[model samples]
Target chain A: MSRSTPLRGVHESLGATLTDFAGWQMPLRYGSESAEHNAVRTAAGLFDLSHMGEIFVVGAQAGEALDRALVGHLSVLAPGRARYTMIVNETGGILDDLIVYRLDEDQYMVVANASNYALVARELADRVRGYDARVTDRSDEYALVAVQGPRSAEILTALTDADLDDLKYYAIVPGVVAGTPALIARTGYTGEDGFELFVLNEHAVPLWNALAEAGKDAGLVPAGLSARDTLRLEAGMPLYGNELSAAITPFDAGLGRVVRFDKPGDFVGKAALERAAENGTRRRLVGLVARGRRVPRHGYPVTREGAVVGEVTSGAPSQSLGRPIAMAYVDEGALEKGSLAVDIRGSQEPVDVVDLPFYRRSK
Target chain B: MSTIPDDLSYTKEHEWVAGIEDGLTVTVGITAYAAEQLGDVVYVEVHSEVGSTVAAGDAVGEVESTKSVSDIFAPVGGEVVEINSAVVDNPSLVNSDPYGEGWLFRVRVEEEPEDLLSAAEYTALTSGES
Candidate 1:
């Protein structure tokens, strides 16, 4: 059975199209997904991210346990800092991408994707068996809502007394928002300035209503998963199943810099990841821009000189770029020549080989 | 709910057929219900040419949204007498005015159409679907 998020009632009352995503009934859109995408790019948009997982690791050796389990240097991270890291298997395959926030001296929170959080929590629990840390999956107790876009800070600053100006990007602080306790994190997946607010599940409705009221004139719409997917795509960020998978590693997806071998102690997949660095990947991910309106979707074959050279992973008609763009895993041969075309339903449409980040914020 | 005009006939495929009283020359397009589910249409491609033959339930065109693409099926069998060049050039009309300016093709009927639903029946089909 598909579970409902804390804000499911609000979404239904607003006439959203609810779809089953990753075992949860989530809102696909409010009305026009393109408009929601544009709103986040130009103004601000609200997102119900309660379906995301929040796992806590608390103890004297919490940071040490994370360093041994993942592929990042988490021990040296400051209290207010957050680091984006990943958990890999013994074969150096990526399990899930995570964000670890050091909340206090003995406390750290690991934010995970809804689809893989259970497995990630289990993995963390098992990895910390000998350590002086305890892993707890507290996803059910918290609710998350994000206000994203260029005008997010202005809108959020109105509702909270916290020092929004002093809060740098990738930093987290505990504060009260709209009369509810929340962890304000200056991080987002949309490649825009935004804050992910984590509060008690019962406080979700009031917080959403408050943000909606505060950002009424600033064009803050209740954005859904449809717009979120496209916004992240425009930013060239990878989704778990689309770009990063159990069969693919960080090195293959052009995100090898995330794995830090220089960190102390033996971490999981360290040996295999070291070999991946010396010998480059066989198939690499590249960006493809369609010459026409045909959207190059996932699993579509990419060809070069009449031979299959790659496969499309994630694709959509980009509203920001006003063209169809895709990320594909191509053979090393195609990556070398930078020449390829996507076979979109038996027709070979030529694609311009471009570097990722199809659209960028002014910053 | 989308508007289902009582004056027109519909297919289970969610297309509206019109101009039937004009001696077998009928105009066809996807109904407003189908357009809403498709989100914002970015591209439209009609496979039936002005003189090509089409059959009912055949995929004669393609409508693409940002996240997905759906095939536009022919509601009735006929020779494609006309294609809407306006919709081909500008696909957003499919969402803006699906039954009027967004009509996909016109057919010179080859035989009697099959499985055409009235506006009430089409309304019943889409009422609790979304």
Candidate 2:
């Protein structure tokens, strides 16, 4: 049996289509997924992200332990700030892409993907051994709700007095939302200005209702995993399983910047990452905009002149771009030499090589 | 619940058949339940073009949605008499009006269809699914 989030009943009441995602029964969409996708692009949308894992590391050596275990240099991250990072295996293959939030001087919260969080927690516990720190998986204790889009601030301002104006991007603040204590973070994967509220599991339904009520007039709709996937694809964000995998390195995915080789002391995969940085990658991630309406989906062969070069990682019909978009790892130098196409089933649908982030929010 | 028109006959593949008993030509479209399952339809391609012959259970066309793709099979052996170009241009009509504007094609029948389900039977089939 698949596990359900705290807001599963609420989603059922709203008539959401539920699907099993990463062993969790999550909302696929409330209604027309295109409507939900448009709502997030034009106005706002609320998301139930309780299935995401939250692992806490606390003690005097919390930052030090994280710096040794992960790719990013976490010791230098300021309090109440978050950084997008990743965890890699001994050979530099990405285990999971993570968001590390330095909640306080000696406390940090690591947010991981649902499918890989258990392994990530176990890895963290093992990596932090012999240090003055302890890793605890608190995923079951929390419920995450995100309000994302242009009018997210307007909807959140009415519910909380927590200076939304001062909450810069990638920053977190301790505040009360709808009379419940929560941690508010100004971060999102939708390429929109939004806040992620982390609260106890018991408060999930009430918080969802409160956000829905506050956002009713502001055109906030309940979005689900379908809309979320398209939105993040348009934003050019790499999903863990689809883009970054156990076989794909950060450098191969064009995310070599997340690897901090200059940090003090030896970290996991440091030597392998250094060699990868020096040798460069054979296949590089790039964006593809379909010239035709046929969607280039995951695992589809990306070809040049009928020769298979790489495969699509993530793809969807982008509401913001008004066409189908995809991210694929194509062999280097083949893109500049000739035109490329994605073999959708059997037909070679033409596509244009575009830059990452097919859509960017207007600031 | 998705609407299952009482007058139309349904295939186990989630397609509805109209005018199977009236004339040589019959209309075919995916059911609303199938459309809902596919999410927003982005592209529709009918492989069996007009004036083409097809056998029963032959894959005639395919519908591409945001998340999935499904094949549109021929309910009965027939000649493709007409294709819905409007749905080909604006595929969202498949989700908005699966029975009316989203009708995929009209096929002139060559043989009697076999094992097609009544509306009640289709409803029962879908009831077990959902």
Candidate 3:
């Protein structure tokens, strides 16, 4: 039996192709994937992301407990602010990458990947057994929706009383959306101006309908996971199962900036990260752009000359750029930008190693 | 759903075969159902060439979309005669008119085609049996 999100019926009504992802049956596309991807890049698009995991940490020692659990210092995060953090195991391998939001002095919410919800909740709960904080898994009760693109703010501000102009990037505010109490966060996986609204499961239908009506003239279309993958890859954002896993470290995954070594508390995998920093990481993630419409796919071997050097973790033809691009984890010394080849179904296709982001929004 | 043309014979794998040149040659392409499932074919790769003898169920080409990559198999044993260059440049033709202008290849039959499902049989294969 597959689980359904709060917006499952809405997706089905729009003639979306459904597939199982992270134990939830979600939409893969609606009509055409390229149209949805281009809509998010050029205009605006909405996504139902309620399948993500939401965990809450409460009590007086919440900040202290979070500091001991992840790599970042959550204590310094001011109220109404959010920071991207990582939870690692004893061997400096990433358990899951999450975003920490300081709801109040003693209250914090951690949003994580849907597939790693149980593991993250269990690990955090066990780590804080002696602390005063309590971990509560709130994934089922909440629903998340993302409105992303260049005109996202213009459309979203009409339905909420919150001051959208003051909400800086990586900020969160307690507010009401469509007459329902919700948490509106200025964060998204797509590299665009966007807001993530978390509302009660029962309120999702009304909120989605309200946003769709308000955003109709602004060129907002309902997008699915297929467009989400291509948009994030163009923005150089790493997907958890693709670019990150239990065996991948922060340094190797191009996420070293999220780690704080000078913090006063000893977090999990602190010593191992220190050692990894001293001796450089073995592999590094890089971006590759193919010459034509043939996109390099996941698990495709990346070779230089005739020697296999790495494998593509994510690849897609960017609807915004009209070309093929990918991300691959290669040796640290092989990070130089040059000519490369991607094995596409027993044939080698020429590629160029350029900068991280394949496309950037014009200001 | 569009009705499968009575003149064409279909396989269980959703490939359509139409007799050409008085049954000496046949044109092959994916059925409309297969093209609909494979949204927006971006690339098509042909592995077999002219004059190469192939067996039924052998992979002759591959079609890639934004979501998946699928193998295009031979519906009947034949010698490859011609490949469709138009679909290679504009793969959306497969979705528009799969049985007509979207034909994939032409082949010379090695023997009389057998074990193929008819249009009605192919429709039954996709009609909510699962």
TM-score, cand. 3: 0.95
lDDT, residue A286, candidate 3: 88
Q: Sort by lDDT, best first: what order?
A: 2, 1, 3
Each candidate: fraction of true contacts kept? 0.88, 0.82, 0.53
Q: Write the per-residue lDDT of candidate 3 for residues B1-130, one digit (tens) a residue.
A: 6567777789887889988436688899988888777776777766799889998889999887887888999887889999999988887788877888888998888866778888788888878532
**Which pairs, if any, clash in model 2?**
none
List per-prediction Cα lDDT, in the order shown. 0.91, 0.94, 0.88
Candidate 3's residue-wise lDDT over A55-119, tens digit each? Answer: 99999999989999999999889989999999999989999999999999999999999889889
TM-scores of all candidate predictions against the true structure: 0.98, 0.99, 0.95
Candidate 1's C-alpha runs over 4 A off are none
lDDT of 1 by residue, B12-48 (tens): 8888999776658999998999988888888999987
Candidate 1 chain B, run of 10 with poorest lDDT: B19-28
Q: Which is the leading candidate under DockQ?
A: 2
Query: Residue A201 of candidate 2: its Cα lDDT?
Result: 98
Clashing pairs in 3: none
Model 2 over residues A33-106: C-alpha lDDT tens digits?
Answer: 99998999999999999999999999999999999999999999999999999999999999999999999999
Distance from true location, Cα of A22 in model 2, Å: 0.4
